[model samples]
Target: MTIDGSHAEGLGEVEFDDEKHAEDRQFVRALARGLEILRCFQPQEPLLGNRELAHRTGLPKPTVSRLTHTLVAMGLLEFLPNHEKYRLRSSVLALGYAAAATSGIVELARPIMQRVVDEHGGSFALGVRDRLSMICLIHCHSKAIFTLRMDVGSHVPMLPSAMGRGFLVGLPDHERQFLVDRLARVSRRGGQTTQEIVQRAIDEFKAQGFCASYGEWLHDILSIGAPVISHDRQVVLGLTYSAFSYATARATMNEVMGPQVRQVAAVIGDEITRLRWRP
Candidate 1:
């Protein structure tokens, strides 16, 4: 993985040079296709017919039917009896939870996130962007108040949300623009002006050294986040802490949270450099 100049050169680009690169590519392509089918179900289109799935994935009807049937058999997708459509099932969460439970970063960050939340009295989480949304990988709830309890598979839009912005601010300009253009065209939220969103991203990259979202995605929720780095200084994932309407005081949050976020990000980078991935 490489870091880009915009965030100090964008994460150069993650390339794999495995001994079995060709074989790995085949598996990756299959996974990509499966993910594309899953992505066809969204917040709005939670259930889709075989025809719609074919249209969304650009696969033939027979192929879509077979894929959906396979997913149903695997308990990853479910059929809606009344609607005659298929939607994601709860079993998929088991896969996500198992992956995180076995992942080294999540295992390391789990305890650290708890410590940070306990010390700061705010919610903290580790997340990564999956396709167009940021998915919560691990979370430590800070307060008993109405804080965001985003589950393991909870996905949030990449713009107008602190968790997503934290990852986006460090992205290359081209990638950032791509996200902005796509969201502006297809996002299901309110009348948030694209210019405001772009300027907010720029401001986050400048002043705070992180993105701060106040009631943008969820009402009365406030969050501040920064990108977690790898040994090579690549911004690989994001770390964030959030609080309800009253828990986070504006001045105190600004003075303390930003630096703390950077500190954790640096630690993440150092840890990644020291750790090794297994085959």
Candidate 2:
């Protein structure tokens, strides 16, 4: 699969590469289509109709209808007679929870991340790349009244957010290039080219061991992030510390929180290695 573009909520347009899998005898197009249909649902938009699902997945309405019916029958989606739309059911959440439970990283990092939030006055998060976005796997916040409200499962734009940049820099060279090429196709925002923005992130990471975003992802948010990689280089995640821009200064993030978050990321990586958590 490849990402074509993204919605305002950072859900990427999932495009199945037919030509690449055409010669594979084990490829199941129907199964792929069904999963793609499930992926169409996002946190910001819980209810979706066949027309919207068709648009998001680039599938025919008839196929979407069949898939939705099958998904409803399988208890993955709930049909609403009042609105002629479907909402994700408990089964989907169950699946996500089961997948998350298999990973020890969240459990291992929870106390450590919470301690940061306890000492500092911001939010700390761990995220993984999901297409052209970063999906929060874990989040902790301070008691501040104005802390960022994002929690687990929140999606942030990959090309703009500090967390996303941290994840991007953790990827292998070929994988990073592939994603950058796809991101280049997205429309420019803030009058900055994608390459230019990504280059700045790379340079910042190289110079300071962390990436910083000041009023870039959101006009009122300031953040610093670092990448976490497993010992074998198979698992990559992003760690971030963020606060409202009005409460935090850019220089503080660059000089203090940047290195602090970088150290946290390294500690999490070491814990993952010690525990031998492969997931």
Candidate 3:
């Protein structure tokens, strides 16, 4: 992932299919195909027919039909009568909601996130990497008039998102390299895929304590984030402070918002440490 300039870079992932893991007896092809079918439905393009599902998931039509039928019967997907398409049902939402509701990070970070929102006038996001996407667990939309439409469960591109960069930088060295290699493979940014380009952002994180992206994910958007490290669980929570580029310059966000977010993240990490390691 490469964010423009010294600011940073990235977005990327791959899934393991049954064939890849078929040697293991526990590998379930049906379950994998069913889940893959669900993931094919994008939030932007919510409705898709069986053929489209088959095309997107690379599963055969018959397999997709069977999976969709099972999913619809299970209430995880809804069949559209007129369109002959299927949309993910609220049951799918329940899965993400349940996870977010149960997360100790959201519980501990909400107040500070709100404070960041109030002060910064942009948005504060607490997220974790799911493959090459940063799945926002908590998004504190600022009270300021200027705000981005985002909330819990929003998926931001990993390489381009500040939260993603912070998460990448926060990863253990070998783990970071492994993920970076994955990003390199999936990257389609016209030959901008190189470890050297991404290393600048990591160097920035080492020097500034936060990583940033200026117009990498979305045009005219700027974000700075740091990783929340818990002393006990080896947890690295990705948190971001972000806004439109017109109002908050890259350097300003890096110098000011970065530190503020890092501090708030530290508080959350401390709380987690206290909760998990309390004697």
Q: Quick one: best lDDT, which candidate?
A: 2
- Give the least accurate 10-residue stretch of model 3, judged by summed lDDT: 1-10
Q: Select the stronger candidate by lDDT from 1 and 3.
A: 3
Residue 218's lDDT in candidate 3 = 75
Query: Which 10 successive residues of model 1 have the least lDDT summed?
Result: 1-10
Sort the predicted structures by lDDT, highest score first: 2, 3, 1
Q: By the TM-score metric, which is better: model 1 or model 2? A: 2
Global local distance difference test of model 2: 0.83
Q: Which runs of model 1 end up more than 4 angstroms from their true locations? A: 1-35, 39-63, 73-94, 143-145, 188-196, 276-279
Give all candidate RMSDs, comma-separated. Answer: 8.0, 3.6, 4.5
lDDT of 3 at 237: 67
Comparison by TM-score, 2 against 3, better one: 2
| Candidate 2 residue-wise lDDT, 121-172, digit = tens | 8898888888888888888888877788675676778888888889888888
Per-model TM values vs. the true structure: 0.73, 0.93, 0.87
How far is 230's C-alpha from truth in model 1 (Å)?
Answer: 1.8
Q: How many backbone clashes does candidate 2 have?
A: 0
Write one digit per residue (lDDT tens) for candidate 3, span 1-279.
112222222321337465678688887878888888887665556788999887767778998899999999999999999999999899897887777677566677888889777866888887877776676778787666767646566567667677888788878889889878887776656646547646866998889888887777677788887887778647776888778888877777877787897788788888878877221
